[model samples]
Target: MEFDYVIVGGGSAGATLAARLSEDPGLSVCLIEAGGRGDGILVRIPAGAVAMLPGYGKINNWAFHTVPQPGLNGRRGYQPRGRALGGSSAINAMLYVRGQRQDYDGWADLGCEGWDWDSVLPWFRRAEGHEDGADAFHGGDGPLQVSHQKAPRPITRAFIAAGQELQLREREDFNTGDNEGIGLFQVTQFHDPARNGERCSAAAAYLHPVMGQRANLTVLTGARAQRILLEGRRATGVEIRRGRRVQQIRARREVILACGAFGSPQLLQLSGIGRPEDITPHGIEMRHELSGVGRNLQDHLDFILAWKTRDTDNFGIGLRGTGQLLRHLARWRRDGRSMAATPFAEGAAFFRSTPQVDRPDLQLHLVIAMVDDHARRLHLGHGYSCHVCVLRPHSRGQVSLASGDPLADPLIDPAYLSDRRDLDLLIAGARQARRLMLGAPLAPYRDRELHGMHDDMTDAEWERHIRARADTIYHPVGTCRMGVDEGAVVDPQLRVHGLQGLRVVDASVMPTLISGNTNAPTIMIAERAAAMILAAARGEDECAGHQAARAS
Candidate 1:
């Protein structure tokens, strides 16, 4: 098969890019996805995330595991990436958080010319169809639906009130460039009458609607890309494995990699496009040398504080809670509004760890249920959880190949808490979260602390508790850094530094991790990248037209 553009991984970036590129009708685009089409019931229901997030059966999750880290007392962390069409956006909590404005401006400061906050804000607006309608900060009509939670639990409101009781200001909007207070998070969900309260994944928003409508677009599910088909330094196509057969899908214009932070780097290294150490060690012949393919790994390492409560307002496995959930499910089917539409991690807050900090350096997610080990371990009865994570950590890690086999999982090492500074910030954040949980507003729901946490615990005790329980809150990026520096894997325009006809549009290209959830920002990146790709194609066509006129 041949097309003008062959995008690998029909996830957030690829789905958005394919839809936008095919808009012209003159260009044909092919999207290759390793998993199913991502339209399953578990993917559509907002509350189905509880079933898929733990990755127990690998339903829509990659369920990758990291190498045991010394920082966490030699513990292996779980990395649950979405395997289907929408990528992690399909299986995530659906929180629509775009990191602080400085996040994008920091990219520009790093020599990524067009990625400053003011420059990239338009792309963010362009991808959003916010419920609040068009405004300077939000778009009225866009592919992705962003909406207020239809029916947040009473406990969620209490959590926000608790933040306020602790002197944290309540912020109704978290996307207004400055997210330095507490509030309920607006989610990426459908609030339209027809599909009210369903998940608005990247595929749901950008890919599924245009599937059969556009003949110029092709979506291949269950097709795993084995390697990039390269001639010298130029990428021409991709070699994929579909079921029992291997096929080559050629690209006439370009081959874009949107396989995300982990997959993008793994595929590049598998195709011999990374550093010699990563490629030649696995018996793969070197195709091109890029040293920054799988370096600069960054993620949000979070620690959760849970309390077992008699309050049944939150979700739990108890008989009473289960009965409540059944009723909510019925209500959701009728009007698409109930606890069935909950994102689970409903309340959110951003704050500084220290008074001297210029911006909020810590973030909190107040879950309306007891969450232990990413929900892999369940506790009986109703309870609540408060998660605190350093918005930006000083530690960095890398992704590398475990073997030459394309099917083998990549070796992931996030090096969590490697720097003492990260631990210090986390310690401070945990203290602040503890204060909020103990505030007057939450006193009615307060019960026994699950992890033996006490109000008078020393800093040393907090450090021990953190090391024993902390893990990732999902966000990961920067494995394929983009900048103008020599170590950058992609240039300012997202093109591979030393390769032609190849570009990577995914979280992997972020020069640094943003301060909040990554799903919204990843979609925004694709929106902007689509514009840049089309503009370049037009430039090439214009140059060819002028050359033909001169010859005639």
Candidate 2:
């Protein structure tokens, strides 16, 4: 099969890019996804995200494990990525955050022109369909849904109140590029009563609505992209595997790689477009010598402070929790407003560890359940946890080829908390969480701290505890960093340097991880990329027309 554009990975960016690019009726686009179509109820329901976490790598997730990080006492961190059409957006906690203004400005500072907050804000607004109508910062008539949970748990309210008691401002919106307050997060959920407030994943909003409807777009599921079929330095097509059949599909114009942080770099390396030293070991002839193809990996290192709770209103285990869930499910079916609509981490706060910092460098996810090790190791009871994550870390890691085989998973090493500052800030963030939890508002329901934590630990003990317990918040980026530097993989236009007819339109191009959830920002990235792609296409068409007229 042939297409004007072939997109690899039908995740958040790929889905959005296909939907936008295919809007031009004259162009043909193909999106290939390695996982199943994201149509399961577990993928749709807002609260069903919990069930998807345990059996992640098996069902709809990649569930990749990292190399034992020396920073975390030789503990291997768990990294779960959505394998379905919507990518991680399908399996993530659906908080609709777009980081701070400086995050994009920081990208501009890194030589990424036209990517500052002011320039990118329009794209962010263009991708959102906010429930609260169009405002200066939000869009009301876009494809993706951004709305509040039907009914927030009382515990979430308590968390907010506790934050207020600590003098933290209560922000009603975090999407405005100023997420420096405690508040309830607006989630990516379609709140239609008919749909029971199901999750509005990237697939649901961008791909599913237009999959078969668009004659110009082709979406292929369960198709694993093996390698980029390159002619000289130009990418001509992709070799893909489906079932036992291997086939090659041609791309007339360009191949856009939207595979997330891990998959994108892995595909690049597998296609022989990485460091010669790295590729030579796999016995594959190197096609390019880009040193930054799989380097600069950054992720938010989070620490969960779990404590047993006395209330059953929040999510938990046991007979009482089960009964509460059943009642909520029935209520959700009737009016689309219930505890079932809540994404477990209902409320959050963004604040600096100290006053000297220019912006909030840390974030908290207030989970209404005892989520330890991504909930793989469950404690037996009703409890809650405050997930403390460093918004920006100085540490970096890399993704490299595990083997020359395309079917093999890439070796992921986030090297979490390798920098001493990362650990220090996390320790500060942990202390802040304890302060908020032990505040007057949340004290009524507070039970003893779980995971053997106590208040009497010294500073040294805190550092030891953080290194022992830190894990990923699953926002990996910067593998295919976009910049003008020699180490950069892609240029500011998102075109891969030293390569033709290829581009990377995904989170992998992010020079730095955003300060919050990555789904919204990634969609924004695709929105900008789509415009650039179309603009370039238009320019080429104009040039072709001019030359044809001259020949005539």
Candidate 3:
């Protein structure tokens, strides 16, 4: 098989890029995904997504575990990545957060040219079709739907009110650059009265509507890319396996890897483009010596604080909760407004861990449910949980090859809380969440603290609790960092170092983790990457046309 562009990992970036690039009538594009089309009801219904979270076998979640972290007393952290067409956007909580403006500016400062906040803001606007309509900071005509929570429970409201009582100003928009506020997170769903609110995943927004319509675009589901086929220094095709039948698909122009933070680097290393020591052990011939293929890993280390309540509104794993959910389903079907349409982590707060930070460094996702271990472990009684995470961590880890086998999972070490600074910041955020939960506004619903904790605990006690209970908020980035240095995997244009016809267009290219949910930022990255690719192709075409005219 052959195409003009071969995109690996038909997740968020690949789906968006395929949809955009194939708009040009002359280009032929192929997108290969290792999972299904992601059309399950659990993926569509916001609340039903609990079944797909990590340890649950519902979503095509590449439920990866990290190496033992010395900081967390040798406990391995869980990092789940979506394996379907929409990628994490299909399975994630659907929060439409763009992160702080300083994040992109910081990338530009780190040598990624044309990626400053001012430059990338347009791309963010271009990808979003906010329900709030077009404004100075939002776009209404874009493909991806961004809307507010349709039906939030009373517990969610109490959480927001409690934050406000603590002097946290309630802001209507978190996507308008400065996200320091307490509010309900706007999500990637369009509430249409005809069908209830549908999860507007990138596949739903970009791929599903256009795949069959475009003859030039081909999508291969259940296909895992094994390695990149290189002709000298240029990538020529990809060797992929589909149900034990291996095939080579050649690309005439480019090969793009949108396999996320874990998959992207793993693919590169499997293709023999990582550090020699890493590749040599597996008996694979090293094609290149890019030492940064799987370095600079980053993620938000989070801790969940739970409290018990008799309120049926706070969903739990019991008979009363089942009845409540059944009632919610009926309401959802009738008016397209119910708890079923709500992403459980509906309300949120963003604030600085310390006053010295230029932007808010800590974030909170106030869930109206007792979520434990990504919903893998369930609580028996009615309760709620507030998830607190450090927005930026000083600790950096990596993704490495566990074996040469493409079917095997990668070695992911986020090294959570490896830095003392990260622990301190997370501790501060946890204290803030604790205050908000115990505040007078939430007193009406509070039966008691479900877990072991006193309000007057010392910092040492808090630190111990944090180490024992902390986990990932599911945002990971920066393994294949974009920069113009020797250690960087990709250059300013996202092209892999010392390589041609290959590029990384996912979260892996981010020089650092953003301040909030990564789905929006990942989409923005695809938008910009697609623009750059199309422009370059147009230039090449123009030059070729001129040469043909001269020859004629």
Candidate 4:
């Protein structure tokens, strides 16, 4: 089949492109996703991911496990990437944060033109339909429906109190231009605009509610893109597998890969476009020797120590519990409100690892309910937990071919904490977590031990404990980094360095992982990349939505 554009993955980036490109009606877009539709019971419920991440209800997660990291005390990690529509954003805890401006400026500094925070600000605004209405730094009518928590959890209130005691300024809206304080984030909520509202993801924002009637857009789920079809030097389309059949799609315009950080790099390697040395052993012919295709992989690694408390009412009925479930079905319980939509989580604030900087280097995610060892073995035993993940990680890793077969598992090395700096920062986060627990506001919840924490533990014991339990905060990026350097897989325009008719527009292309959760930034990248792709397709000067349009 031939298409104007054959998007390889129907995740965050693909959904945006399909919606935007098909707006012209002149452009035909085919989005192929390996997973099924995004309408699963788990995918729709915003706070229902505790059920989805563990166990096997495949709505959008790829459920890929990583090779044991030598740095992580030789322990393997399970990486749940989005495999369905809307991608990981569909399955993630929807915290809508546009990371520090310096994160983007750092990209431009790396020679990726037009990617500075200033240049991409409009695109960020363009993708947001903020619930707080709009401000000079936000957009009101964009496709994405972003809003604050509807029923901010009591624990969330406690978090702000703790921050207050620490003199950390409370930011009602973290999406604003500056992120120099601690506060609740304005999430991408398609349902409600505040408090304990239902979680809204990108698929909910851009694609859902619009998928049923768009004729120019064709969404194909369970379609695994095997490789990009190359006619000479240009990418013509993609070859995919659906069920027992293999289909070929020819693209007249371009092929955009939005399989996220993991799948994107895996697809690039399977298509023979990754590092040459990594490809040769797999017995594949190299189409392009992009050394950085799966390099510079990064994510926030963290582990939260919980203390059992007398608060058994932490779990709510809107999303869980047998009794509340009945009341939920009995009526429109929220009465069309988000803040009181059954308390999901209450504790979240950013704090600096050190007092050197005003903005937080580590973020604290405090789930009122007990979450232990991968959200498994629920502490129905009445406990509260707070997760502190480093906002920035210095360690790097990659995804490479483990075998020649496309179906074979790729070698994923997240190399978490391999850098001594990363180890130190994480230790700082732990000490910070301890400080918060020991702080005045949380003293009431301190009836039990937190992580068996004691002042008597030596530095070596802390490092050992840190190495044993550290896991990803689920933000992964930089596999197909955007830069002008030789190792760069994509240019600042998100164009593959040496490939034609091909571009990677997911988290994979991030030169550095943003300071918070990666979903918002991934969507931001798609919005910006869409404009860039549209501009390049028209041969227009880098003006207006051309990504570089706002560059000073």
Candidate 3 stretches greater than 4 Å from native: 193-195, 540-552
Q: Residue 177: error of model 3 in Å?
A: 0.7
lDDT of 4 by residue, 1-552 (tens): 888888887778888877877776677888888877676656665655766766476435667778998887789887877767788777777777888878788788888787888777888778877776666788777878776665565666776788778777888777654676666766666554242245566666677766867787888887878888887778999999888999898899999998878888888888888878888777888887777888999988877777776543455323345454445433333443432233244456777777786566888877766676667556445567778887878888988888878777678899988888888887777777777766887776656765566876667877988887778778889898888888898887787887789999999998887777777788888888777777777777557564442331
lDDT of each: 0.91, 0.88, 0.87, 0.74
TM-score of each: 0.97, 0.96, 0.96, 0.93
lDDT of 2 by residue, 360-394 (tens): 99999998898988888877668888999999899
What is the Cα-based TM-score of model 1?
0.97
Where does model 4 exceed 4 Å of error?
Answer: 57-59, 191-196, 316-345, 357-359, 546-552
**In angstroms, how far off is 31's CA in candidate 2?**
0.5
Error of 1 at 166 (Å): 2.3
Residues 1-552, model 3: lDDT tens digits: 999999998888999999999999899999999999987787777776777775566466888888898888889888878878898888889899999999989999999987888777878888888887877788887888888889888888888899999889998899888999899999998655544587888998899989789999999999999999999999999999999899999999999999999999999999999899889899889998998999999998889898888887757777878898889878876776788888889898999876798999999998888888777777788888899998978999999999999999999988888788899888888888898889998898888785597878889999999888888888999999999988999998899989999999999999998889999999989987887888789875323422332222
Worst 10 residues of 3 by lDDT: 543-552
Model 2: lDDT equals 0.88
With a 3 Å backbone cut-off (N, CA, C), the pairs that clash in candidate 3 are none
TM-score-wise, the better of 1 and 4 is 1
Residues 259-317, candidate 1, lDDT per residue (tens digit)? 99999999999999888988898999898999899999999999999998888877988
Clashes of 3: 0
Which of the numbered candidates is closest to the native, going by highest lDDT?
A: 1
